[model samples]
Target chain A: MELQEKLKILADSAKYDASCSSSGSNRKSGSGVGNTAIAGICHSFASDGRCISLLKILLTNCCIFDCKYCLNRKSNNIKRAIFTPEEICTLTLNFYRRNYIEGLFLSSGIIKNPDYTMELLIKTIFLLRNKYHFNGYIHAKAIPGASPKLLKKLGLLVDRLSANIELPTENGLKLLAPNKESKNVSQIMEYVKINQSKKYVPAGQSTQMIIGATKETDLQIMSKSANLYNQYHLKRVFYSAYVPINKDNLLPSLEHPPLIRENRLYQADWLLRYYNFKVTDLLDVKNPNFNILIDPKADWALRHLEEFPKEINTCSYNELLKIPGIGVKSARRIISSRRNFTIHLEDLKRMGVVLKRAKYFILCNGKYITNKEFFNKKFIERNVMLEERSLIPTNKEQLRLF
Target chain B: MNNIYIYDGDFISLLNIILYLLKNNLHPENIKTDVYHPSLFENTIYLSILKNEKIIDQIISAFGQYAMRSMYYVFLSKEENKELILYYFFQNALKRRHKIMYYHNLKCVSEVLRISNYVRHETHKMKGFLRFKELEKNILYAEMEPTNNILFLVSCHFVNRLKNEFWVIKDNKRKIISIYDKKQFVIVKEEEFKLSQKESKGEQNIEFLWRIFYKTIGIKERRNERCRMNFMPKKYWKYITEVKEEL
Candidate 1:
C-alpha cells in the first residue's frame, strides 16, 4: 500500500485511544534531536477539539482479538496497514523537527499476539532512541498478557506507559469484550507501580475506561477510579464517552456520544486530583448520575448547604477550594493576597475568582457579596441552571417557523 | 504642570529610569517611553539612556530573583501605560520587599502581575504554536507574530531542546530574529540578518503527510469547531500547517 494510504488507515484506527498528554517528563536533550518539557507542549488541535500533542498512530490495524466496542475488532471489514520500523522513525523525526508534534504516541492492534505486537512497538521506539537520537517524549500502550521481560524493556524506552481498563466494571468487560480481562489491565498497572525503583515509566502509568457503553452508573465509575488511584498510584484515569461505531446486540445505540456526562466525569476527576474530594462526597445512592443542568462541583456545593458562606479572608486553602468556582490558582491567589491586605468583595474579582458562582458560597470580610437567598438550596440550584442554560439543546422544531 | 518623563523603550533604559527615580525620590506624574503620544497638559522630559548594570543587580538583591524575573516579564509586555505601572510597582516592591507581588488587592501590584502573566502566557503559547520549517543547509526557521515581545523567552527553550541543530526564530511583530548556531544564539534586529525563503527538498512531502495525519486523526462523529477554536484560536491558525488549508 502507498504510504499516505497506510497512514490514513493507521491513524483512523488509533484515534479512539484518548490519552494524549505529554506531561511529567523532563528528559533533557544530549546531542540528540529533541527533548521533553516538564509541562508538555501541544503542537496542534484536531477538528474534534482533542489535543494533537503527539503523532498518535498504530503500527497496524490487524487484530487477533475481537472486542465488540472497538473499531479494529477482527470481525469488522476495514482496511488494514502496518508500518515498518523505519517508516515510524522517519515520521516521528520529521514531525518533531517540523514542530508539528511534541512526540509519538504509538499504539497497535494485537497483530499476531500480545507479545509480538509489543515487540514491534519496542523495536520502533528503540530505533528512534538509539539510531536517530530522538530524545523527545514517547507514550506507548502496554499490551495485556505480554511477557514481563518485553513489558519491562518497553517501559525503559518510553517516557510514559498506559494500559486502558476498557470498561468501568468487570462484568461490562466480560459481557462486551469476553476475550479481554480486567485482571490483565490491573497487572500492568501493578507492574509499573512495583518497578518504580528501576525508573520504569518516568512519567508514570495511566488507564482509561469507556463511559456510557454499559449499564454502569457514575458512582460505580468514580469508585472504580478511586480504587485504581489508591492501589496503583496511576498518574491519570481518562474517561472516554463511548462512540458507537459497530452494531452489536450488547452495545447501547445512542444518537450522540454522552459528551456532557463525560465532561462531568472529567470535572469530578479534577476535584478528586486537585480539590481533595472523595467519591462519596460527590455522589450517593439517591443521585448516582450527575445532573446534566449543573456542573459536578456546583452540584456538590448545593447538597452541602451548611458549608456555604465561607469567609474568604479566614478560610483555609482547602476550604476555599471547595467553594463552587474557586480553582487551585484562584485559591492560592486568595491565600497570598490575604496575607498583606484585607480581602474585600472587589478584591475577589481581581484575583481571578469566578464571582458568578463563588458569590453565592463565599463571604468577603464576613459579609455576603450579594444579598440573595443563598441559604435556600432550590434558589441556588435554579440560578446555576439559568447560568448554564446555553448548554441545553434548543428546540429546533419550535424554531422551524423562523 | 506635572512632569512626564520619557525614555527609549528598552529593558535596560527602563531599569535606569527606575534607579534614577529611586535615588532622587522624584515622584513624576507619569513615565513613558519614546512611543508615548505627547499631551498638552503634562510637562514632557526626555531622559537619556544610561548604560548601567548595577540597577539590575540592585533590584535582584532587594526584591529577590523571582521578582526581578516577573519585572522582566512585565517589561516584555505591550501593555499601554506600562512605564507608569512599572514605576508604581517598583515603588511598592521597594517598600513591601518581596511580599508586594502577593498583594493582589493593590491596583498597581495586580496590574504588574496581570501584564507579566500575559507576557508569560504568550511565550508559552508561542512555544507550542510556532511551526519550524526546514530551510536550505538544514537550518530550521520559524516565523511568528506573537502579541508580546517573547522571542527571547521562546528561543531559550528551543536552545536547550534542539541544541545540536541550527535554527532561527523570527518575531515578525517586533522585527527581531534569534539565530542559533548549534552552540549559542544571538538576537538581532531583522535588518541585520536575512533569511532565505527557499525550503529544503522534500519538506513539502513531510508537511503533506502531517496534514493527512491531522485530517484523519479527528473523529468524524465528534467534530466541534467551536471547541477547536477555544484551544487553538483562529488567530493562530494562519501559520499552523494542519489548519492552514482552511485559511
Candidate 2:
C-alpha cells in the first residue's frame, strides 16, 4: 500500500482516542531538530473543532481483540494498515520541520499481542528521538498488559503518557468490551505512576473515559475521574462522547453523538481540577445528569441561591471563583484591581469576567446589578439557560450558528 | 500652547518624548506618531528619533518591569491614538508606582492592559497557525499578516524551538521579516525582497499527505465548521495548508 493510503487509514482509526494535547513538558532542542513548548501549541484545528496539535496516527489498525464500541474492532470489515518504524520517524520529522505538527501521538491497535504492539510503538518513538534527532513533544499510548520494563522505557522517552479508561464503570467495559478488563488499564497507570520522576513522563500521565456509552451517569463519571486524580496523579482526564460506530446491541444507539453531555462533563471536570470543587458539590444521586441547558458551574450557583449577591469588590479569591462568570484569570484580576480602585459592576467586563452569567450571582459594593427580584433561583436559571441556548443543538437538521 | 508632539513610530522615541515633556512639565494636547493628521488649529512639534538607553531603566525602576512590558506591547499595537494611550499609561503608572498594573478599573491602565493582551493573543495564535513551506537547500519560509507588530515576539519562540534549521517568517502587514540562520534570528523591514519559493522535491507529496491526515482525523459525526472557525479564524485560512477549498 502507498504511504498516503496507510496514513489515511491509520489516522482515521486513531481519531477516536481524543487526547490531542501536546503540553506540560519543556524539552529543549540543543543541537536537535525541534523542541517542545511547555504550554503546548495547536498547529491547526480539524473540521470537528478538535485541536490538531500532534501527528495523531495508529501504528496499525489490525486488531486482535474485538471491542464493540470501537470502529477498529476485529470483526469490522475495514481497510487495515501498519506503518513501519522508519515511515513514522520520517513523517514526524518532515511534518515538524514544515511546522505542521508539534510532535507525534502514536497509538496502535493490538497488532499481535500486548507486548508485540508496545515494542513497535517504542521502536517508532526511539527512532524519532535518537535516529532522527527529533526533540519535540511525544505522547505515546501505554498498551494495556504490556510488560513493566517496556512501559517504563516508553514513559522515560515521551513527554506525556496516557492509558485510557474507556468506560466510566467496569460494568460498561464488561458489556461492550468483554475481551478487555479495567484492571489492565489501571496496571499501566500504576506502573507509570510508580516509575514517574523528573525525566520519566515529565508531563505526567492522563486518561480518557467515553461518556454516554453504557448508562453511566455524569456523577459516576466524575466520581471515577476524581478517584483517578487522587490515585494516579494524572494531568488531564479527557471525556469523549460516545459516537455510535457499530451495528451492535451492546452499545447505545444514537442519531447524534452526546456532545452536550460530553461538554458538560468537561465543565464539571474543570470544576474538579481548577475550581477546587468536589463531585458532591456539583452533582448528587438526585441530580445524576447535568442540566443540558446551563453549565455545571451555573447550575451549582443556581441550586445554592443563598450564596448570591456576594460583594465582588471585597470578595476573596475563592468566593469570586464560585460566582458563575468569574474564571481564574478574571477572579485574580478582580482581587488585584480592587486593591487600587473599587470594582463597580461595569468594570467586570473589562477584567475578562463574563458579566452575562456573573451579574446574576455577584454584586458591586453591596448593590445588585439588577433588581433584587432577579436574584430568585427561577429567574436566574431562565436567564442562564437563555444565555446558553445557542449552544444547544437546535434540531436534527439545522446547522449551528458560529 | 496646544502643542502636538510627533515622534517617529519607535518605542524608545515615544518614551524619550514623553520623558522630555514630563521633565519640562509641558502638557501637550496630544502625542502622535509621524503618521498624524493635522487639525485646523495645531502646533505640531516633530522630535528627532533617538535611542535613550536610560529611559527604559528609568521606567522599570519607577513603575516596575510589568509596566515596561505593557508600555512596549502598547507601542507595538495598531490601536488608534496608541502614542497618547502609552503617554497616559506611563504617566499614571509612574504616579501609582508598581501597583499601577493592578488598577484595571482605571481607564488608562485598562487600555494598556487590553491592547497588550491583544498583542499577546495574536503572538500566540501566530505561533500555532503559521505554516512553513520547505524551499530549496532546506530553508523553511512562512508568511503572516497579523494586526499587531508581533513578528519579533513570534520569532523568539521559533528561534529556540527550531534552532537547528534555517527559517524565515515574514509579517506582511508591517513589511518586516525575521530571518533565522540555525543559531539566531534578526527582524528587519524589507519591502522589496521578493519571496522565491523554489519548492524542494517531494514537498508537495508531504503537504498532500498532511491534508489527507487532517481530513481523515476529524470525526465525521462531529463536523462543526463553526467550532473550527472559532479556534482557527477564517482570515488565517488563506495560508494554512490543511484548510483547503473542500474543507
Candidate 3:
C-alpha cells in the first residue's frame, strides 16, 4: 500500500488517543536534522479541539484485541495499513524539513502480539533518532503487557510515554476492554513514574480515563485520579468523554454528546491541580457528581458560605485563591496591587476581578456588601443557587427548584 | 506645522544623523533639506561629519539615553506622525538633560514598544512552531514570513538547534534569507527563488501526505475555530503547505 494511504488509516485510527502534546521536552538541536522546542508546537487543531502537533499515527491499524471503544476493534469494518520502520523515518525527516510537524506521535493496536508491536514501534524511534537524525519530540505508547525490558528501552528514546487506562473502573475496563486489566495498566504507570523521577522519562508519563463509560460517580473518578497522581506521580490524567461509535446493547445510545460534562470534568481537574482543592472537598458521596449549572469552584464556594466574607486586605494568598473568580493570575495581581495601596471594592473590579460572583463572598474592609439580609449560611446558599440556576437552568436544577 | 524629517532611507546613516541632531539639542523641525527629490523635505539640514570615535560614541550614548529606543525603529520604518514623536522627544529632551527620555511614556512610544515586544515574543514562539521538511536537493528549506522581526530572533534559535546543519530562514515579504554558514551569517535576497521545482512530483506527493495527515488528525467533534485561528492565523495559511492544500 502507498505511504499516504497508510498514514491516513493510522492517523485516523490514532486521533482518539488524546495524548498528542509535544511539550516538556528539552531536547535541543544537536548536530541533527531536527530540533525539539520546549513550548510544544501545535501543527494544527483537529475538529475535536485538540492540537495536532505531531504526525500522530499508528504502526499498524490491524489489532488482535477488540477494545469496544477503539475504531480499530477487530469486528469493525475499516481499511487497515501498516508502515515499515524505514517508511516512517523517511516521512518524518521529509516532514520535519518542510516545517509541517514538530515530531511524531506513534501508537499502535496489538498487531500480531504485544511484543511484536512494541518491537516495531521501538525500531521506528531508533531509526528516527539514529539514522534519520530526527531530534524532534517522539511520544510512543507503551503497549500494555509488553515486557519490562522493551518498555524501559522505549522510555529512553521517546520524550513522553503513555498507557491508556481506557476506562476509570475495573468493571468498566472489563466491559469495554476485557483483554486489558486495570492493575497491569497502573503497574506500567508506576514503572514509568519511577524511571521519570530517576531522569528516565524526562517528559514524564500521562494516562487517559474514559469518562461516563461506566456507572462510576464523579467522586470515584476523582479519587481514582488522586490515587493515580499520588501513587504513580503521573504528569496528567486525561479524561476523554466516551463517544459510543459501536452499537452495543450494554451502552446507552445518547442523542447528544457529553461535551458539557467533559468540560466540567476538565474544570474540576484544574481545581484539583491548581486551586489546591481535594477531590472529596469538591464532591462527597452524597453529592457524588459535579453541579453542571456552575463551575466546580463556584459550586464549592456556594456550599461553604461560612468561609466567605474573606477580607481582601488581610487574606492570605491561599485564602484569596479559595474565592470562585480569583484564579492564579488574579490572586497574584491582588497580592502585588495590595502592597502598593489598600484595595477597595472598585479597585478589584478595575483589576479584572469578577465582582459579580466575588462580591457575595468578599468584603472590602470588614463589611458585608451583597445582600446583607441574606448573610446567613442557608440564605447565602439559596441566593447563590438561584444565581447559578438563573445563569444555566440544567434539568437537575429545574427539578430541584420546582 | 507637520514638518517631516526625511532621511536617506538607510538605517545606520539615519541613526548617525539622528544622533547628530540630538547632540546639538536641535529638534527635527529646526533643520531639514531636500536630499532625495521625490521624498525631500525643504527644512532638512545635512549633519556635520563627526569622524571622531569618542564623539560618535557620546552621540550614540546620548541617543540611547535620550531618544525612545523603539521609536527610533518606528521612525526608520517611515511610519506616519513622525513629527509628533520628534516633537514629543524634543519637548522632553529640552526639559532635562535627557528630556526625550520622558517622551518614552507617550502613546506612540508605548505602542512601538508593545509591537516590538510582541514581535520578539512571536519570533521566539516560531522557533518552536517551525517545522522543517527536507527537499530532494538536500537543502533544509523552511519558509516563514512572520508578522514581526522574528526572522532575526528565530535565526538565533535555528543556529543553536541546527548547529550541524546549514539552513536559511527566508522572509517571504522582504525576500531575504538569513543564511548561516559554519560560523558567520549573511542575508541573501532571493526574489527569483521558487521554494520547490514546479515539476517535482516528490514535493507534490509530500504536500499531499501533509494535507492528509493534517486533515485526518483533526477531531471533528471538538473543533475550536477561535483557538485554531489564534495559534495558526489565516494570514500564515498561504505559506503553510498543509493549510494551503486544504484550502
Summarize candidate 1's per-residue lDDT along A102-172 as a digit string, tens digits. Answer: 89999999989998999999999999999999999999999999999999999999989999999999899
- lDDT-based ranking, best first? 1, 2, 3
TM-score of each: 0.97, 0.97, 0.78
The per-model lDDT (C-alpha) reads: 0.88, 0.88, 0.71
Interface RMSD score of each model = 0.9, 0.9, 4.8
Give the DockQ (C-alpha) for candidate 3. 0.32
Candidate 1 total steric clashes? 0
For model 3, how does the per-residue alpha-carbon lDDT over A149-210 read when each residue is reduced to its tens digit? 99998998888899988777888889888788777787789888767743467788989987
Worst window of 10 by summed lDDT in candidate 2 chain A: A393-402
Off by over 4 Å in 1: A372-374, A391-402, B35-37, B48-50
Pairwise TM-score winner, candidates 2 and 3: 2
The 10-residue segment of model 1 chain B with minimum total lDDT is: B46-55
Q: Candidate 1 chain A: worst 10 consecutive residues by lDDT?
A: A393-402
Model 2: per-residue Cα lDDT over B194-243, one tens digit each:
56789989889999999999999999899988898899998887889988
Q: Clashing residue pairs in candidate 1, if any?
A: none
Give every candidate's TM-score on chain A. Answer: 0.96, 0.97, 0.90
| CAPRI grade of model 3 | acceptable
